[model samples]
Target: MNEIRVFCPATIANISCGFDVLGVALDSVGDEMVVRKIPEKGIRITKLEGQDLPKETERNVAGVAGLTLLEASGYDGGFEIEIYKKIKAGSGIGSSAASSSGAVWAMNELLGRPFSKIDLVRFAMEGERLASAVAHADNVAPALYGGFTLVRSYDPLDVVSIPNPPELYATVIHPQIEVKTSDSRSVLRTKITLAQGIKQWGNVGGLIAGLFTNDYDLIGRSLEDHIVEPIRSILIPGFDNVKSEALNAGALGCGISGSGPSIFAFCKGETIAKKVSESMKEVYQDIGIDHDVHVSKINTNGVRAI
Candidate 1:
């Protein structure tokens, strides 16, 4: 095939306790892109929709990811990419990962699928690094592979898909605010106390076990983040009120999605998910903060032809 179109779902990174090591895909919102082969021998971005973004191929996440794949696969031909972004940038919801993964996914189809899923993630991380200056795979891995993902290690780039409970639902609320990823990372402390570290590791272990054993209560109890959330939540308006309201509204757990301005909650069913969404929205509305809410099942399929 000389051309292909793909849709990549938005992802929630740092799922409360994971903090740069865990993520899950959300089915409701994402970005779409089309990649077509061209006569020129380089990657080019031909169109962009939804919001104004940088068009330079090297500067844009999609272009950087596509170029990385083309160079790695030794493809000499050029390709043009068109992006229709649905996920808002700086919303703490893997917006760049959707574009990056979607671009490489379409390019892979056009190139007859030369790269593996892991390689696609590696290439996508280049795009993420261009945007965030961090090569973490919590967002990219889940965006590329779908469902819940665990970045086991970054030294050798080990990523594995964790089992997902079928009945679990997600409610994501994106407030009308911008929180730059760089600033978010900058505000984080570089080290943690031994006591906090032990607690975090135990919670991480419990979360993994909860996913494996399908224990909803364990998952709820393990969704505590004592490190990143305490610092970053201060940046998001009404964060504490919204999280408390979500839990009171039947959400299992709630926390900041990725960095800030967007908050997500985990619920057991669609009805409760909707209720949690409304409760969270009420908090934002009462504060005069414009926001968008999405209630969805976890996306099992990540980037795919559409």
Candidate 2:
């Protein structure tokens, strides 16, 4: 069979408040998967790259995703998978999701396409389950549809593509630290007050509305998250100072991305985005931690073959 290749972009979910719900695709970073049929029966991952990546199916996130798709699609064949890892795993950068989503997408194409993007998303969650023990749709949604997305309810099977706001930039900072998703979730309070829940949902609604209308002010105003951010920020080193620096550099809004250790700051244009990125980098430098910053736009094309 001809080789099938797929690419999935990195995503930052929650954006400070919309925990487990909102996420946006980044234009410049992601991972790739290649799949092809072999005459054998079991799965064989021929190659794996990147830091701390595992090759065994039980440990390889992409391998698990491909096997899950094969089982769901009722295709019985030996498959050779090669994962080109670009996104670093465990930086709260949706690395596992990209691998899973890319594997599912590549295998679907190789099998003459059996699953829809929505169906593949559910299948991809198997990989996340292997890693994070929860079915997260944030990375999967953006990896499938591109642009901004809202996973309103995972169990109820709801996913929507949030409209892209114009003149927006996402400045991402990844510090050299590893915070597992399980640990991150454990840090969150199981029960939040009614007032806090209201505020969180209010920001969510406002973020949605702002995206639809391209209102930067509303988006900025809505980006504030008093609940999850406060609890999760403690996991990352120099989190508060970095956030303050990003905002002080003229960011429209700034907050922790997904779990922690990676911060995303939104700005109105490239100039402010660059400034915010520089400011974030400076904070990490001051803290004596190695970091990387990217001033990127929202990726509108989600995942596609290269």
Candidate 3:
């Protein structure tokens, strides 16, 4: 293929209970990019739209991801990338992951699919590092692999796909506020007590089992975050009110999406999902924060040709 266009879905990293280990792909809200092969030898970002973003290849996540893929594949030919970013940066949703995954996904297609999904995720992590200064795979893995994902190990970059509950729906609300990712990471404690750690791990295990067994209540009960949410939710306006209302409105659970400013809840069905969305929005509206809300099923397809 001389050119390829790919759409990569947005992602929710941490997923409340899992912290940095788990993430899920959303059906809507993503970034699109087109990669066109050229005669010259290097990667170039020809266009960027939807948000004010760096156009430089090295500074841009999509460009850096595409470049990384090219280097790894030993491809010397030139390519130009055009990005249409629908996901907002610092929304706590995986905006950077969408760009990073979209670029490498399109690049792999242009090069006749040279890399595995896992390798593409690895390249995307490098792109993520450019944005967040941390080469974390929680968001990138789900953006590449779809559904729910577990970053079982980072030393070898091991990512495992977890089964998604068929009836599960996600409600996401992105408040129009700036919450720097660096600031989010800086507020986190380096360590947690053993009791807190144990509770978190137990919840993580329950969540995974719930997904596999289609146990909706187990999934709801397991959505507790004892470590990250308490510290990070303070950064988001109306976070506690939104989460409480969502749970009261039939959401299985709700918490900060990734870091802050974007909150997400999981519901058993579309009706409950919509209710959760409305409840979350009401809180934001009361706080006078401009926001965007999305209710969607789990994206089974992460990144795909358009």
Q: Local error of candidate 2 at 126, Å?
A: 0.4
RMSD (Å) per prediction: 1.0, 1.4, 0.9
Task: Write model 1 residue lDDT over 260-303, tens digit each, in one string.
Answer: 77999999889999999999999988999899999989998899
> Which rank order by lDDT, best down to worst?
3, 1, 2
Instruction: Report backbone clashes per prediction.
Output: 0, 0, 0
Give the backbone clash total of model 1. Answer: 0
Residues 109-164 of candidate 3: C-alpha lDDT, one tens digit per residue: 88888899999999999999999899899999999999999999998889999998
Pick out the ten consecutive residues of candidate 2 with the lowest summed lDDT. Answer: 42-51
TM-score per candidate: 0.98, 0.96, 0.98
- Candidate 1 achieves a global lDDT of 0.90
Report residue 241 deviation for candidate 2 (angstroms).
1.3
Q: Each candidate: what lDDT? A: 0.90, 0.85, 0.91
RMSD of 3: 0.9
- For model 2 the local lDDT of residue 299 reads 87
